[model samples]
Target chain A: MKFSATTALAGSLALVLGFAAPAFADIKIGATISETGPASFLGDPEAKTLKMLVEEINAAGGVNGEKLELVVYDDGGDPNKARTFATRLVEDDEVVAVIGGTTTGTSMAIIPVLGDAEVPFISLAGAVEIIDPVKPFVFKTPHTDRMACAKIFEDMKKNGITKIGLISGSDGFGASMHKQCLAIIGEYGIEVLADETYGPTDADMTPQLTNIKGKDGIQAVLNPGFGQGPAIVTRNYAQLAVGLPLYQSHGVASDGFIELAGAQAAEGVKLPGTALLVAGLLPENDPQRAVVVAYKEAYEKATGKPVSTFGGYAHDALRILVDAIKRAGSAEPSAIRDAIEGTSGLVGTTGTVTMSATDHLGLDLSAFRMLKIEDGGWKIVE
Target chain B: MIMRLSSKATTLLILAAVIAIAPFFFPSSYYFRVGSLIFVNGLAVTGLVILIGYAGQISLGHAGFAGIGAYACALAPIHLGLHPALAAILGALLSAAIAFLVGRPILRLKGYYLAVASLGFGILVSMVLSNEAQLTGGPDGMAVPELGLRAVLKAVGIDLSNTEFWYAFSGLALVLGAWLALNLYHSPTGRALRALHGSEVAARTVGVDVAHYKLVAFVISAIYASVSGSLLALQNKFITPDVAGFMHSIEMVTMAVLGGAGSVLGAILGAAILTTLPQVLTVFQEYEQLMLGLVMMLVMIFMREGLLPSVAHRIRGRGE
Candidate 1:
């Protein structure tokens, strides 16, 4: 044991020395991700796709005739880890850009590192504040809770739902909805009859559902979630036998949610997902239809599985950044930042993205397509 | 033990000198920035040495205090209309109060009970911070008001780069904290706490107010954590709930243990090493967490007495 310990130190010393005199390195793009931990539900797959996407970028003659070297650090869905990784990337690796933060909380932790470094980043976390206070350098790919609120309410308006009830996850995701649902629904002249919340790892959202069900004029349901919270809602919504339209946040719109919620429980449950999720059901003439289908084919061929919006987003995120780098003809962070800000009509598997100087969250309400679960498959409702 | 001091002090002076003068060799301003973070983290670990090493009590929730300090910077201006410096003081006071209240009950419990209770307390604090949107701006995080200290210093003919200021300031803070902790290690109360650590029952038989000494350590450590957290937020100008999370608390403990928790200087060194290691290991970014876990386990396995104390003992024995 003593010998091995000494040898290990020696090996690390050698490794350090080896790094001192390196060849001209590739454009180091760092990503802080949750490769392990509870949120690995999303982060594990996100990590896998990050690797594949970087490999693909390099294989295609690389970006700007230089191989794209991706440096990813696992945050384990932890804010401290994300902060540590972010600091390391900016200070040590001196990477040109940063990407990925699986959980909302972790992304929040990394804000200081990016802000201090002024490194351009494309954050995978869906929180608006992650980009809001410090724009120009930070960009987010996913839609915000406010947009989700708007999209869900828009569907409620279409369905002639005058009264609504809300259930949300008890952590940051739930708290965002709890605060915003009333405001967003109020704008549509819809009344919120009840607001309920469930713990993130809770196996049952029934008591919350039962409370919401008791409220008068409850014509529909709205639940915001990412983990099992939505699945619990879907199951409880069915068991209650109350025949009212249910509107869910896009978090539960994943195929895994449907499978977990069971087929019968999912029907008529509406959400604001993308055509990319169930592109097979999208019309052939739809613009995103072809892009999504190609992605599904490529993803399936590579991972030997069906394509998720996760893989789609991961692919698009790297593509957009690499495209920006190639466009700028330099790996300098400011140039890439400017190029990203000016991006318009860039089509991806999900939808056309357009970023502006003011708004780093590139996706609009239109980026989402309203869908209702029908016949065990998500079909367009509007 | 008498002879160990001369050798240990020499080693410590050498280490401090290296850190104080190391930036001249930095290849870029970036190195200065990273070195500043190491110093900042080292300051926090120095506080942990007082709690974990001298007091011989455990706290699995120091990060909650850090959150208090960070959010104070972020929330003080927006919520209470207070300046950032006063907010930092407010954060430290709040952390001390909270630690005092929680430590009263938990400090009496030994071993895993204290660990679990402290862990629960930390999780609850973090949850409220994340869930309370109206006040904390929720999990999306809020911008911290910038510290005008450097600007103030500039007005007084004190010219320093942001990186240089943080490195020097954090280094000074760590040195002050370490000096105080070292003094306390030799004080009457410190001796009592160390006696209690050796045997709780024996401590009581010898007229040691074990509970009071333990609570004092907990509160002081919390104040240290809060100040470190404030320094972090002020430097970065952003704050988030993640500051109070479980992993951060664990990382603090790990650094304390790695540095030879018995001495604040050793803890600071541990903090510096871990802080810089991952930055240099960018090529193995994917394995960063795995490496941390491995290093922590290896250190705990072999370096039972900790990095500084153990190494000093070996050198003293060789000299003898």
Candidate 2:
């Protein structure tokens, strides 16, 4: 029972690396992001917001007499790299819980490894399948492709969109949106006039758009969740003068779409996401008001720029994981996972986050807000 | 016995033996996790050794075969009512068929032309896997049906954990794959293919049936890649387009070169080292790509024969 100095040192290192560095003398949570990939546009801000939130939590006297140490790994949207980082965080860093992988593909790759280890993970990637066949400790912070389809279709229905054409990336995000489009378009009394597809690295969508536009009587266009796919689609829609109510999946932010598509092309295009995008349009008493205000102030101070809801989810994911650690009162993975699942009425920038065993998604279908580009930015549809 | 190995093979044998035994002393299940990954990757690289080393043809899209094998497990049971194991076989068949077709046309091309053709083929496959949502579940990825091999084995009193099963299974697969490939290396067909690799026109003039041997090599290597892919997907219980991406294909090739592609065991050694090094190097996160690029450049340029071959040659010089 006489512990040697080596044994004591090893144990201390295990503790420090087991749940993370204890600089905060409190619970520490970790996030792995793609800070330098094609998806860094999403991952960099996410990392920044994580810092802002951790700082805010520490300033408010820390969590339950402990401070927040937010450890982050840049996945760069690679699956192999993500798995290695997950191990380093789980074994070397010993962080209580981990969050953030920019793309669903990378998120799905690490899900089993994280699950087998019982570490809680939250992803910001816009894929519902990330939560399906669910890992016990995994949760996602975005609306699903299916959910986005249903919401967009409902709005399309309300706006009398009956004849619609669909264009999607031939990638996973594109395929899901295509399926969702096929399923929801029918219910909204919408006919699929034309369906076209393009590759992920494709910089031009003109050929596919020409095919769709060549067909007669297509009244509305649904460009499913993608990056360059929407940019190409919107620009083509303008050049072709389709004049249709072109809707994009929530994955496409208004800023990029407008910048890529030109102002006239993006003038009436719609994208769906959590209300954090158009916080100014929500009622004063909206649940997101305080979160938006607080996050905006923090983000500007931290990064010296405007913040988007993508960053909001990244912040929320870290906060929720930390909150679970606090409630569990221990760094045990199973304990933290249960604490996260049972959390209810936890206010986040997106909405009230409440996850249960059956549903790992926090925000509901009602949480999606429809916004369009008016002058230069998103305008909440009146 | 050591002198009989040729200094290069002697060094590779030592390195391989060391890696095979090293994980036993791993302080935690974490190293086993990485060990199993190396085994999986080495299994694929072993297949590449037959193609790249023995046959002298290149496949920049072998990962596409891995995707087929992976999605076979993912899509088969859900759509076709097949078992995961059966799906793996079916995927292997699909890969062989595709390789046969793709090889027939582009195997005729040599050097950079063949490399670029294979690279294009790989990118196209990844795009299809990511884009075709209904069948393959595109970029979000689909969960693979668990292999249940371990579960079935356990039911018959063969109990194993996730890490242990993959570790032993992938290791066994590598050995078997290497043994088969080694057997082929000594076979008449293997000799004929190597003859063609040495000089295609000379082999053709000498009646080696260069095209036939090349096609056979392509299909056989494709099957190896497919089975490796199936094992990887089964091990993880998931599959994504990244498995079939051009980058993974290149990684497999680099691994083959790293171990001295001429030796199957050496290829596995290369795969094991590359797979495990990143785990240890995670502390140097920012320098990852830079380090990988540098290691690859230095190894290929200075150590043209590979880590094992060059080290073995240097040690032999000391004796002289």
TM-score of 1: 0.88
lDDT of 1: 0.77
Pairs of residues at least 3 apart in sequence or in different chains that clash in candidate 1:
none
lDDT (tens digit, per residue) of candidate 1 on B1-320: 56755745654566568668776766445556666677777777877887888878877888888889888888887878999989999999999999899999888777766678778888888888877877887765667887888888999999887767877777677666666666677678889878888888999999998889988888888889998989888876666777788878898888999879987777877887687665555446567668888888887888887888888888999999
**lDDT tens string, model 1, A256-360?**
888998989988888888777878888877877777787777777877867777666666677779879988999999999888887787767656788887877
Tell me the spans in candidate 2 whose CA falls farther than 4 Å from its real position. A1-28, A55-61, A80-94, A132-135, A149-175, A181-225, A229-248, A268-270, A279-284, A304-306, B1-20, B76-82, B104-113, B200-207
Instruction: Assess the local accuracy of residue B199 in candidate 2 as a C-alpha lDDT between 0 and 100.
Output: 94
Please state the i-RMS of candidate 2. Answer: 7.9
Considering every candidate listed, which one attains the maximal DockQ?
Answer: 1
Query: Per-residue CA lDDT of candidate 2, range B1-320, in tens?
Result: 34533644544455457557766566555556667787778878878888889888887888888878887878888989999889889988999999889888776765666678778888998888976766776665677878778888899999987777887787777667776787787788989989988999999898887777888888888888888888888887767778898878988998999878877767877887677555444446568779888988999999898877788789999999
* Candidate 1 regions with alpha-carbon error over 4 angstroms: A1-28, A64-66, A80-84, A87-94, A105-118, A131-134, A206-216, A329-332, B1-12, B105-116, B157-159, B199-207, B280-282, B285-294
